[model samples]
Target chain A: MPRQVRLRRHPVGALAADDFHVVDVPMPEPRDGEVLVRNTWTSVDPAIRIRLAAVAPAGYFPAFGLDAPMDGIMAVGEVVESLAVGFESGDTVWHTYGWRDYAAVPAGAGALGALGSLRRLDTAVAPAHAYLGPLGPMGLTAYAGLFDVAELCAGDVVWVSAAAGAVGSLAAQFAKLRGHTVIGSAGSDDKVAFVLGELGLDAAFNYKRGAIEDQLRAAAPDGIDVYFDNVGGDHLRAALSVLRRWGRVAICGAVSQYERDRPAPGPDNLFQAVANDLTLRGFRGSSYTDRMDDMQRDVAAWLRAGVLRHRETVVEGLEQAPEALVRMLAGGTIGKTLVHIA
Target chain B: MPRQVRLRRHPVGALAADDFHVVDVPMPEPRDGEVLVRNTWTSVDPAIRIRLAAVAPAGYFPAFGLDAPMDGIMAVGEVVESLAVGFESGDTVWHTYGWRDYAAVPAGAGALGALGSLRRLDTAVAPAHAYLGPLGPMGLTAYAGLFDVAELCAGDVVWVSAAAGAVGSLAAQFAKLRGHTVIGSAGSDDKVAFVLGELGLDAAFNYKRGAIEDQLRAAAPDGIDVYFDNVGGDHLRAALSVLRRWGRVAICGAVSQYERDRPAPGPDNLFQAVANDLTLRGFRGSSYTDRMDDMQRDVAAWLRAGVLRHRETVVEGLEQAPEALVRMLAGGTIGKTLVHIA
Candidate 1:
């Protein structure tokens, strides 16, 4: 038998561990063109919360059905049985069949699909779990947002919110590595220290310490040219206030308010986009597939050069997946939160 | 003597007639490279209200100081004295020295500078006041917002808010001329009829009649591809709800809530931009100077072909400029409101 996490009920406000159920099920058999994967690691991303609503937010990610096994973003596993070409038994793979101990999926599975298109892992370069963290969609998101969306210029002053989180941490490092000054904001002093010390950001602040605007003003006396926003609400408002003329905002996520029952009021100063000639553009990582090769090359090069680093917070076992997700949403975990299921 | 409108005090909320005081000053003489003009028409634009705030909204239009003669967007006049080349006496000119009877400005003034760079008017195609109405920044705003910002395509379903106002009316007409289905919303029944009957929009609704979301859904059941937003707040929220995937919103104005003392909460569903892959860009007419020649050519051709029509509400005399602005802001005027000054 294999174990998986299923949605017990739709969450009302903040998510609770009880909203998810751990279930034991018969192991799935690999059909033709399918590979049976024994999961090693699974990811817990905050964005999946949008799909947990009773009625999925219109036009967003598809919702999970009640009492059904829920799909998540990333999973690292080993092929135990293979009935598909290009995949062999005992090969390491990464796919989207997450929150479960095992999955039989099409061998071509990529980000959101089955295991058929599953990417073969090279452990010589990095560990298998790295594919679910710094080397995966999280890293690609940071790369595409800063380079492609924000068009980060050399010597630009950049501010990133949620700087200790998966995407924000990478974004800050990428900006710094590209000859730009980086200022980051995090929820706690430890996270702030991690951003400034390990991440080597130009300046870092604990948003929980004081008003984000006041702290941003002090950190970057000269206003920021680009704001990479992850936490919405007041952080967005503060970024809007400090963005210089013709500044750009790459709206990545709204982690702070994603779990709320009601949508939070948007930045009141969004009208500033008109006055300052600013561009506030929202993009998802999936839309930038064309840049994946470039991102993989540059990020891997940076990692080899010791100019970039990766971080993850790991929890043991499939049953702990719900706790990991709740803690990630509650800002209790740093960097990427992953479940070690083997 | 020349009569001009000056600011009595910074408006707190809705503007009052007393907020402006008309004063008579000695006629000015043109310096070398300067031109003196006798104003015949002045434009009352809603955008000017941002300048009336005591503390200017940061990075926006500059605020008007107490007791200082205020400058406005457009005015049509006859050059009475010319000391600069290209501008001759009695030449019809258009400049930003509105709300005044007479003024002397440098001959080389460009946009966002002193009043000297007054544009020479050609009345062969239309009347002089038409320059401050249909052929002015208002019309250009509609043109650029549709073609440049929204990138409106043929057969696209479009929605325009404030559909009976100057820019909104022109935008609806332009979208229709391009073979798109246009739906519009206005504050009053009469305005709705004007949009549907006069503007020939596909469907029109009085936003005051019912919830904007319900009305918009009924009017555009399939969904809208482009949204030309003039009135912000609930109207913006409604548009976000019904905008189809990859829809674009040209954020031209927020006349409905611009005069409020406290900044209004932004659209609750702005996060939809990420899910719907929508683009919401804010732009000012001044940024589209390079498109002016094209706009003039197309608009004139349309006017000549009877494909486009324009409307204006005229209030005689410079002293009535404040009242005109107040009325326009209050949604009491149907189209462009101008003070006919001589």
Candidate 2:
């Protein structure tokens, strides 16, 4: 028998552990053109909380039903059986049927906006779990967001919100690597220190301390050219205020509004975007899958050379996946949050 | 002595006729390298309401001071005296010293985001007041917003809010001229008729008749590719809901937010921008004066060829300039609003 997490009920206000539960199920067998994957590491991300809602935002992923298996999560696994021509037994692969011990995946199929493709992992580049973070969707998001979406130009002053977390840390480090001024903001002082000391950002601030506008202004006195937004709401408002002329904002995720029971109204000073000739673009890592190979090539080189640092907060055991999500959404976990199953 | 309109008080809620007072002042005389102009036609715009507040949105032009002449208003006049080498005494000039019978202006200096440069007008394009409407800032705003900011593409389904008003009408017509399917929305049924009948848009709707979302969805059955946002708030929310993948929004103005005494929070569903990979760009037309020659060439040709229709609700005298603004802001005027001085 294999086990998988199921949505117990839709969450209210902040997400809690009781919203999800793990249940045992029959072991999945690979059918024709399918492969049986034994899941090893599963990702816990802020976007999951959006699925926990009774109704997800329109045109986005649909809401998870109660008492049902949760899919569309990123996971790294090893194949035990293969009925597909391209896949072989004993190969390490990444799939989308995450939070489960076993998954039967259709060969060469992609889901979740083309991010979760059933593809073999290159262990020569990094470890299997790295696919769940920097070398995978996370890396692609940070790279495409900076170079493509925000169109990071030479001498741009960049600001990355949630700067100690998985995506933000990578985005901040990438900006620094490009020799641009990089400012990072996180929820806690410890995270802020990590961004400044470990990540080597030009400036760091704990948003819990004071006004985001004042802190951001202090970081980039002349004003920021690009804002990588992981937290919406007041963070977005502050970004709009501090962004210089022709500034661009890459709206990745809004952790500030995700777990809330009700949707919050967007920034009042969004009018500042017009006042300053700013562009606010919203995107998911999945939207830029075309640039995945480019991202992997750049990030893998950096990771191997020790130029791009990677960190993780691993929660042991499959049953604790819910807890991992709860902690990560609460900003209790730094860097990437993952569940490593034995 | 010359007469001018002065801001007697900051307008509250909706603007009123009494918010301004006409006063007699000493006639302006040309100094060395300055030109004296007898002002004729003055323009009324929605952005004036933004400045009428105690404080304008940050990074924008400063608020209009109480009991002061609004120097940044656009006007077309005849130069009566010139000490500047390039300008002759009888030159037909368009200037920024509006809402007055006389103005002394610097020869080539610019103000108000480079939009208020004193320059000669070519009445061969149409008439002096046409410089206040189709051949002026109104035309520039529409052109730059569609082509430069929104990045309008071929085969893009376009929606222009406030489509019967000054800038919106031009934006809608520009999109229509490019052979894209265009939808126009206005506050009243008669204005909707004008967009459909006179402007020849593919679809037209009165936004006040029903839910903006329902109306927009009905007008654009599949989805809109580009949104020219002249009216924000609910109209923006509706656009977010109806925009397809890779859609773009040019935040040209938010007349809905300008007249309100208190600031309104933005769309709750702006996250749709991310979900749909949408880009919302905010800009003022004055920022694109570099495109003025291009705009003048195209729009003047359209005006002369009778392809681009220009309409106006002209106030009889300068004393009614404030009333004209009030009417325009209230959606009581069609196309462009202007005060013609006798």
Candidate 3:
């Protein structure tokens, strides 16, 4: 028997434990072109909060339907039973599986391959959980946003909002390595210090203590050439105001307004984008799926070379997934938040 | 003697008559590597409205100091005197010049040129002043925002705000020519009708009379693929709500909040951009300077073949420049505004 967390009903606001039901199901044989993966580890993200809102689908995946499994970015266990062509028993993999003990999925699942590695888990270079963090889609997101979209170059000054989060941490490291003067904004003094002192950011600020505009002015006196946006709203406006001529802004997420009942107010300084010849873009990891091989190869090399590092807040057991998600949403966890299910 | 309008003082809000003063002076002689041009026609764009709001030493043009002329896009008379290597005295040319009757500019001013007479002016293809409208950077802003930045492809459905304005009008036409289904919104019933009846937009709405969200929903029953943004604020919010997953938005300009003293409320639907995996971008014409050659060549061809069209509002004389700008700011004009100084 496998325990499954089924979406009993769609949620209207913050997700209650009742919105999902943990049920035991008789193990079934895999059909042709299908593989059963025993879930090992699942990841929690800010986007999961929006999935529970039941308003409309937000972010990279489809809207969740009532009484159905909510599947998204996740890492899984071995193929215990496989009727699929390529997958074999005892082969560990990853897929977009709902919170469950087991999953039977098609070969082409969620951005599993693009998120990180599924074939081999390397604990030496980076922990298996780090595979879901810096070595995963989060890291790839930072790289792609900085290099491919923002066109970051040496000597550019970069600013990052939500600087202590999964993507933000890696982005700052990446930008620093690229010879850019990097500054970050975080919610707490500790987080800000972590980014500046430990992460080696040129400067960092606690956005919670002061106005974003004033903080930005102090951090980037000369102005910003690149703004990697994770928290939208006022942060976006602040970034827009301080952007230099022909600056580039890469919007990977907007965690600040995701949990609100109504949409958050958008940045008010869009006019400056035209006046300063700035470029603001919204991006997703799926768009760069094909580049995973290259991204992983490069990231793996950087990790080995000690150029990048990551921190994780791991929650144990499958039953704790709900709490982990809540903590992540409340901004209680730093870096990447993951649930390890044995 | 040459007559010119000089910036008398920084404007507080809307430019007043006292903000500028026309002065007469002896014509400047052609210096080495310079040409003396008799001014003919010039352009008046919405951007100049902001430039007039403040006095900075080298804000608009470094060469134009205190009590100096304001320079912008212009079409000039023959080169009365040339000292540069590549120019002749009788050559008809265009360059960015001040609001003046006569001027002297460097021969190598990097002005836009006709490619082997490929630049014959057309009236049936587009309104005459469209030479600066869809035929100029306004048109290219549309093309690049749609095809380049937004990466709008064939079969994509488009939603354009400020549909009758300089850039949005051309965007609708450009998208339609590429086999895209186009929907547009305008402030007036007449402009809406013009977009649908004359411009052949698939559907058009009067944004003033109906709720922006409701109108957008009715116009785009199948969801919007691309949003050409000219009016930010509420219009942008509506566009964000209606945009489909993976939709692309080109941030062309924000006419709605252009004149406001403070930044307008942020769009409530921008978070949708992150959730839907949408791409929202802000672009400036100068960033696409490299594409000017290709765009001009193709646009000219499209006009010659009657595949594209534009509109123009000619104010007659340079003295009427202020009024033309006022009309544009008040949303009274439907197309490109040009001032003939000859």
Clashing residue pairs found in predicted model 3: A58-B275, A59-B275, A59-B276, A266-B266, A266-B267
Task: State the C-alpha lDDT per candidate.
Answer: 0.85, 0.91, 0.73
In order of the candidates, what TM-score does chain B achieve? Answer: 0.97, 0.99, 0.87
lDDT of 3 by residue, B1-342 (tens): 688777777665565656667788888887897778776666777666556655321112222344876765455455787877766766665566647877787754443221111122435544444556656667667777888878887778999988887788888888888888999898888888888888898999998897999989998888898898888788878877888877877877776765666557777766666556666677666567666667777787788888775766777777777677778877788866778776
What candidate 1 gets wrong by more than 4 Å, as runs, is A108-117, B113-116
Rank ordering of all candidates by DockQ, starting from the highest: 2, 1, 3
lDDT of 1 at B254: 87
Q: State the lDDT of candidate 3 residue by residue for A1-342, as single tens digits.
A: 677666676665466666676777777456777788887887877766666655555344666566666666566576788877777887766677747788777764344334533344546665566667776677778888888767898788999887888889988888887778999999888788789877899899988899998989898898989999988888998888888877888888888777666766676667676666677777776566666667778789888888776877888877777777767666677787888888
In candidate 1, position A188 carries an lDDT of 90
Best by lDDT: 2
lDDT for A115 in candidate 3 is: 53
What i-RMS does each candidate reach, in Å? Answer: 1.3, 0.9, 3.7
Clash pairs, candidate 2, are none
Prediction 2 global C-alpha lDDT: 0.91
**Two-chain complex of model 3, DockQ on C-alpha atoms against the true structure:** 0.41
**In candidate 1, how many clashes are counted?**
12
Candidate 3's TM-score reads 0.83
